[model samples]
Target: MRKEETVDYHIKVVWHAISRMYNQGGAMKGITASSGFVLLNIDQDEGTPATKIAPLLGMESRSLTRMLKTMEETGLIYRERDTEDKRSVRIYLTEAGKKQRDFSRKAVIFFNDKVREAVSPKKLEAFFDVMTTIDNVIEENKNLDQKIQLIENE
Candidate 1:
């Protein structure tokens, strides 16, 4: 099959386009797309567990560690030891971080609103349903590569 006809290709293309747009928006606010995403994932009031942020954002631990370091140095976030779990930490946004987080939220809302205006609600629902099915299939086929190799050898 042609690369363009594949689901993965389309998903990747769309993600790249969206990432570029978000990065541009983030640049204007003195942050990168990655940093902006981290800001958005952080909780405003209670603070989020440092460990939880990576999984919630689907980010690599090392990447997040670097960003968190930068954010801390820049006074955008502060970390506190969890009271119940001394070894665990929670991340809280500084005032500057809250402002940046607001910007990220606004950007997301604007983009989603525009998409909602352009696409019918039914189509959007169907798209989400299809994506959920795709995710489920991948999860169920975690050993797909090994299975494929065995079949090829047979």
Candidate 2:
């Protein structure tokens, strides 16, 4: 099958397009798509734990650390030691970060609303279902490579 005809290829292409769109939008606010994503995942009420932000954003911890440092340097975020867990740190948005988060939220909502207006609700639901099924299938097969082996007797 042609690469363009593959499901993974299409998914990757669509995702890259979406990421580029977000990055373009984010650039206006001096942020990247990745930074905006991390900002959105952080809780607005109480601070999010430093350890949890990476998982919430589906990011590597080392990468997160760098982003967090940049945000901190830019006065967008600050870290505090958790009162309950002395070893743990919580990340809190600065006033600037809150503003950036609001911008990010509005941008995302606008994009979603536009897509919703263009796509039928039924089709959107099916799209979500297909994505969920793909995730489940991939998750279930994660150990397949380690567990399965095919060989021919010589």
Candidate 3:
């Protein structure tokens, strides 16, 4: 096979493995991954405004709002009106959210172990670096029209 075809095949295989792991895992249910990720990200940057969280996650504000509402109903997160900015709400994980975060951490460790068992440490590290680079490249290539649309929709 040509080099490009080989690269595409490997990318598909990696994505499939990741999808399967997330879907089958107890802690990281496929449907809830986005909410979990947003929760974890908010935990890392506590007190971040809700508006900012959606953009950082590359998701729409409406979708994030729905996710937040679900999480709040589940007792996983709490939103408080920002003291300095009454119109803006800040997100914070509740006790249950912390527990979810712990579960996600363990799930990621389990997933990493599975990967390590299948691939060498060096290869895993390389794969991680390559994926990060690809993400960065995509972010950097955002066009003016896309940016404008994102802002307009917000």
C-alpha RMSD values across all candidates: 1.9, 2.9, 6.3
Better model by TM-score, 1 or 2?
1
Clashes of each: 0, 0, 0
**Judged by TM-score, which candidate is best?**
1
User: lDDT at 101 for candidate 1?
Assistant: 93
**Residue 124, candidate 1: alpha-carbon lDDT:** 100
lDDT, candidate 2, 1-154, per-residue tens: 9998888998999989989999998887898888888889888878999999997776799999999999999888899999999999999999999999999999999999999999999999999999999989878888756555532322
Q: Report the alpha-carbon TM-score of model 2 versus the true structure.
A: 0.89
Score each candidate by Cα lDDT. 0.93, 0.90, 0.77
Candidate 2 residue 101 C-alpha distance from true site, Å: 0.1
TM-score of 3: 0.68
Pairs of colliding residues, candidate 1? none
lDDT of candidate model 2 versus the reference: 0.90
Sorting all predicted structures by lDDT, with the top scorer first, yields 1, 2, 3
lDDT of 1 by residue, 1-154 (tens): 9998999999999989999999998887888777888999998998999999998887889989999999999888999998999999999999999999999889999999999999999999999999999989988998999999999999
Q: How far is candidate 3 from the true structure (C-alpha RMSD, Å)?
A: 6.3
Least accurate 10 contiguous residues by lDDT in model 1:
27-36
Which residue runs of candidate 1 sit more than 4 Å off their true CA positions?
144-154
Select the stronger candidate by TM-score from 2 and 3.
Answer: 2
